[model samples]
Target: MALLAAFVGTPVAAAADDPDLTSFYQQKLSWERCGQDLQSGARSDGAGQPPGFRKRLECARLEVPRDYGNPGRSTMQVQLIRLKATGPGKRLGSLVLNPGGPGASGVNYLIDSGNSFANLGRRYDIVSFDPRGTGHTEPVSCGSKLAPPPGSGADDSLAAKEKRINEACGRYSGGLLRWVGTQDVARDMDVLRAAVRDDKLNYLGFSYGTKLGAVYAHEFPRKVGRMVLDSVEDPTKNAWQTALSQVRGFQRALDDFAADCTRQADCPLGTDEGKAQDQLRHWYQQLSEQPMKVKGETVDETSYVYALREALYSRSDWPALRQALEQLRHGDGAGILRLSDAGGGSAAHSDSVPARRIGQDELPPQDQLALRAISCRDTSERYGADDYPRAERELTKASPLFGPDIAPTLLDCYNWPAAGDDASRDVAAPDAPPLLLVATTNDPATPYQGAFNMARELRNSSIVLTYRGEGHAAYTTGDPCVQRHVDDFLLSGTLPKSHTSCS
Candidate 1:
C-alpha cells in the first residue's frame, strides 16, 4: 500500500446523522495557531521529481481519540502529507494512500516515489499519512536485537538468527500488534475522511493496502467513492489458506523465472530449464547441510531460501538473483550476502539494534497473542498443533526454496497463543461498492489467483483486472491498459466489464 497526491481543497467539516459516529466528513477546517500562523493549503517539494514527479506537498495534523470507542480519552496526532490539485474548481478532496507491510511508511513512500503518479495529480489532491504505529506515527519498536545483520549467504549459522528474529518479534511486539490489523486501520481511515472533510473517500491500494481498502469498504460502504485494489489478497482467508496460496504464487513466479532464464544467454543456472531447476533445488539442499560464508558472516539454508523467494517479489531484483545463482554455482557467497543485507538489517537507521532503532513514534509494539487472536478468530479455517508438521512437509514438497519460510510462518501461527473466537464472527458484507480488483499475472506476493478468488467472493466487485505483466501491483506502473482502467475507475466512476485482461 503506497500513496501519491496533489491538494484540491481547503479543509472543511460535514456532519453525519449518526451521533455515535467517531468520524465525520468535513472540509474547509480552520485551525488557529498558538501565536503563529501556517498556510491553510497543501504543500510539496515544488519540482519535477521525475518518474513519479515530486512537489513540496502541504501538511497538517489532526487530533484523534486514542480509542475510537471513547473520544474523550487520550488523543494522538495523525500527520498528513498532501499534493494539491493543479485544477481550479473545487476538486475532489483527496486520494490517500497506504503501502502494505502494515508497517511501510506511506508519507516516506510518497515523498520518495511521488513522481510516478505524474498523471494522477492533475485532478485530485494526493495525500498520504503515517498510519498508526508506522513510520513517524507512534512507531513500534522491538529494541536492539531485532535488527537484521548486515549481508546474507548460505551458512549453517543463520538458523539461530532466524529463530532469534521470530522470538524477538514475539517478545518485543507488545499489545500494539493486535491493534494494527486492517479493521483498526479502516477505522483510522474513517477518522481521516472526517478530519479532511470529504463526504466520500477515493483510494488506490497496493498489496496489503488492498486489504485495508476492502475492510474500509465493508465497514463504511457509503464513504467509498472510487477505489482501486491492486495485487489483492483476500482478508477472509485463514492464515493457512493465505500461506498455501502464497506458496503457489511463488511457484508460479519461479516457473516464469526458470522459463525466462533458460532463454537468456547468461542464464546462470544454464540453458536446460530442468537442469536449472534441479541445480536450484540441490543448492538449497547443500546449503541446509553446509552453509556458505561471506566476510566471516554465516547464513543458513532458511535465510538463503527466504531471500530467494523474497527476491522474486520484484522484477528489479531478478538481475541480483541471477548473480547470486552464479555465485552459488561457483561456491562463492558474496552476492547472496549482499541480497541478505539489502533485505535484513542488524540495526535501524539509528545504528542501534533493530528492536530499539525504530523510534516509539513509528510503530506501537505488537501483541503477538492478540495478533493471533484476531487473525485466527477472523479465519474460518483452523489448524491443530499436530497439523503443522505434516503441512510443513507437504509445503516443502511444493517448492524447496520457499517451503521452509512459508511452513515456519504457518507453524508460528498454529502455535499462536491468541484465542480464535473473536474473529470467528463474519465481517465481510458482500453488498459493499463495486470493487475494482487488479492483479499482475506474476505477482510474487499476493498472486493473480488470489485476486480472482477475492473478486469471486465480493458480488459487488468488478471482474478481475488482469495485468499480463510482472511485479506485485501494476496500478502505479502497469501497462497502459491497466493504467487506463484504473484511471477511468478512479476519475469517472466507470467499472470494467465482467473481467478485463490488460496485456
Candidate 2:
C-alpha cells in the first residue's frame, strides 16, 4: 500500500517552533495526463506529468522530507495520481487507495484498475501514490549483483546473499533506509490528508496496505474517516510470527488447491491428496539434488517451490499449476519455468521461448530491496543463523511444504543495520470512527486469523467483514457482497455489525 502528500493553493503552515516542515507542507503540486501506451512503458516526465497523455489519470509529484525530523535539509519526491470522480451525484472527498506491496506503486494500481473503484469514485476523487523506496519515490536500490540468482536457495548461499544484500543496501540506500518504515509512511499520510484538504482520511488498503492503514489509524485516530482494510495484517505479529503464520497459511492454501486439483480429470498428482503432496515434496527434493532442464532452461528446487507458493495465492491459478506439475512429472521443465516466471522469478534465468505475459505486478529489484529494508526496519525481530535449526523444525512440522522455504527468509533480517523506533504497539483506535476490516477466509498472503486479530485489537470501533472465499483479499474479486459493503462504508460511513459474513 501507499501514502501521498500534496500542497494545493496555499501551503499548509507549519507549527511555530516545531518540526519546521511548513515549506514542504505548503509546496504546490502540478498535475498532468498520464498512462498513454502504458503497456509499452510510456510514462510522464521528470515532474511525473505526462504531456498530452490521453488518459484521464493526472500524475504529479509530492516533495516530502527525506526525514520528517529534518524537514529542511533534504527531500524525497513521492509520485501521486488522481482520478477525479465521474459523478452524477454529490461528490465526497478523496478516497485514497493502496494495493498492498510495501513495494507496489499505488499510482500504477489506480491507473490500471480505477474502474474497480468507479462506484466509490462517482462520489469521491480516487487518489494514490508511490510511498518512499517504491516506484519513482526515491526508490531504494541494493544493486542486483547482491541479489541471489534464481534457483540459488541453499542455506549457506542464501545467508551469504543476505549478507551481501545488507552491505549493498547500507552502501546505496543513503540514510533514508531507516526512515522508510510504516510509521514514517503513516506520518506522510497525515501530511497528505491535510494537503488534500480532507477533514478525515478515507482510505482503502489491501494486503500490506492494511498494516499501513492500521498504523495510520493508531497514529492519527481522529483524522481517520471511512477506512477499509482488506486482507488485514496483524499489527501484533512480530517478524518471525508473521513469517511462520504465512508459512502455515500458504501450506493450507496449497492443500486446498491440491485437493481441488485431484478432482479434475487431467490432474497430474492423481486422485489422492496425500500422495499428491508427497509427490510434490519428492519433486522438490529431487530438484534440489539434480536441477531439471526443460525448454533449454534450468528449473531448480527454489524456482519450483516459489512457483508452487505463487500459484497457491489464488485458486484461479490452479489450472496452470496442475499443468506445470504434469509437465514436471513428464521430465519437461517448461511448464515449471513458465509458472516460475508468473511467480516473479527472474526472466534472465527463464528460457527464450515465448511464454504468456503474466501481469507485471511483481516488484522490481529496487522495490524488492525496499520491501526487505522497510520490513526489517519496521519489526523488532532479529533472527540469527543459529536460530534457524529450531525454527526450521517447528515450521516444517507445521507446514511441511512451505516451512523450510519460509524459515530461511527470516535470516534476511539477521544483523540488519537499521533500527526502527516504533515497536509493535496496541492498534486499538478507540477515538477513531468506525473502521471496516475485510478478511478472506482462505487468504494465502494475509491469513484470515490476522483479520480477526486486527478486529479484536481495534475493539468495538471496528467491524470484521468476512469474505468466505479463497484469495489474498476480498474486494475487486467479483464479490458483489464485499464490494457493496465497502462502497456503503466509503460512501455513507455504514459499518456492518461486528463479525458480519459475506459468503
Candidate 3:
C-alpha cells in the first residue's frame, strides 16, 4: 500500500507551487510562565485537578504547518513547556522530551516529570510539547463522552461501537486526523529543533515517544545528537502484532502481580491462585452488568480493564492496582477511576458522546483519542467488520486475561474517513549516530524483546541499555545505575559498556 494516506500529498495546488516553509521554520516562540494557562497546580495523588506547574517552568506555543506538504494552507499551534537548565555547569543547549503518548500531553508530562530529569536539567533545558491530536495541541476528540442515549440499540458489538467512534472522530478531527502520524510529528519536531536555534536535536522519549524519536532520526539523521529512547517499541510489528505482544506482556505482569497479591494477608484477590483468577474475572462480569458510580463517573468493565492494564505498566503501580481492586470490592471505585483517568502512552480506551472541544476534563481524555487516531494514521492497514473476529480470537488466545478487553481495539482505524500512510511501519536511519535505547527486561507495555528488534532495524545505529527491573521506563524509576549511564551519555557522549545491564 502507498503509505501516505488519501489525505497526504494531495497538493492544495501543485508541488511546484508549495508555499515557502522558511517562515514556519524561522518563527520565534513567545515564552511565558505557566500558570492558569495550563491549569497549573501541583499534581495531587489523585486526578481531580491538573498537575501543579513548577515555579520556574516556562511555557510557549509554536506554529507549524498543519500539513507540512502544504505549509501555506494552514497551521497548528504546538504547545511547549520547558524547565531551563540550572547552570552551575556549562549549558548543553536544549534537550527536548516527548512523554510517549502518541496522544498524551507532553506539556503535562513536563510539569509532572520535569524534576525527574533535574540531573540532566543542570546543563540542558528540559523541553516538552503537546503534539498534534494530543493534549492542548488541537486534540482529536470523539465529541463529548456521553452515555448511549436511551433506545440507542443494544448492539454493543466492537464493530458497532468502532463504527460510531470512527464516525465521531471523522466528524470532529477535521483535516488533521490523518496527519497526526509519527511521520508528521517528526517533521514538526524538526521545525521545533530549528525554532529552538539548536543545530541538532537532543531528545528523550518514552514508549511511543521512542517511535517518534526513531522516526526523527530517520528523517533527519545528521541532526540527531545525544538521543535516548526508553521502553523502545518495535517498528517491525503491525498494529495487530503490537497489540498481541503488549497483551502478552501485560498478562505476564498481571500473573506476577496476582502471585504477589496472594502472599499479602490483605490481598483483595485472596490467596488461592485459581480463586484469584476467577475472582478478578468475576469483577469483569459484575462491572459489565452493574457499572458502579465513583466521582459521578461510571466504572464499567472497559474502564476497569483499562485501570487494571495501566497499573501493570510499572511495578510501582501494583500497590495502587491492589488498592483499586480492594476499593472495587468495597463498592468504592475511586482508585479504579483514578487509574482510568490517568491511563495512556502505550494503550488506553474510552467511550464517546456528542461533540466536545478539547479542554480541561474532557471525557475519554485527548490521549486515548489521539492514540486511536494516530495509530490508524501511522498504518495503512484498515480492518473491516470481518477482520475483527479473527483479531479478537488471536488476541484472546495470547492472553485470556487481557485479550478480550484489548481485542476491540484492533479496529481503531476501521473505515477511517481519512486514508493513512505506512511511513512509520519501517524506519531506516543508517546515518544517524548511535542511539541509547533503555529497555526493561520485564516491561509490561513495551516488551523487552522488541528493543533488540528496534536496534537491529535502526541498522545497528543503537546500543541497548538493559535495565533488569520492572517498570514502563527506567529513567523515572529512580535507579541510580540507569541514571548514571544515561547521564554519562548525555553529559559526555560516553557509551555504556557492551551488554551493560543494571538492576
User: Per-residue lDDT of 1-503 in model 1, one digit per residue for the tens?
Assistant: 01111122211232453234333223233332211122211133434465333325566666665565555555566666777776754576678877655455566656655656656777787877766666555555555545544456522233333333444545665444444455656776876776665667799877767777877877776677787888887655666666777777788788888788888887888889888889888877888799877788776676576557656666667888888888777888777766755531100111000111122123223422222333433443445445767767877777666665566445333433223342422335465677788988888678677777676655565557888876676866536888898878877788888767887
Better-scoring candidate (lDDT), 1 or 2:
2
lDDT of 2 by residue, 67-120 (tens): 777787788778888888889799888998987767666766665566667788
**lDDT ranking, high to low:** 3, 2, 1
Cα lDDT tens digits, model 3, 285-373, are 89889988876778887777778776777778888999889988988888988887664332211211101122222334456778778
User: What stretches of model 3 exceed 4 Å from their correct place?
Assistant: 1-19, 40-53, 145-156, 270-275, 289-297, 326-335, 342-363
Lowest lDDT 10-residue stretch of candidate 3: 347-356
Using alpha carbons, what is the TM-score of model 2? Answer: 0.86
lDDT score for residue 483 of model 2: 89
What stretches of model 2 exceed 4 Å from their correct place?
Answer: 1-17, 35-54, 147-157, 343-364, 422-425
TM-score of each candidate structure, all chains considered together:
0.76, 0.86, 0.86
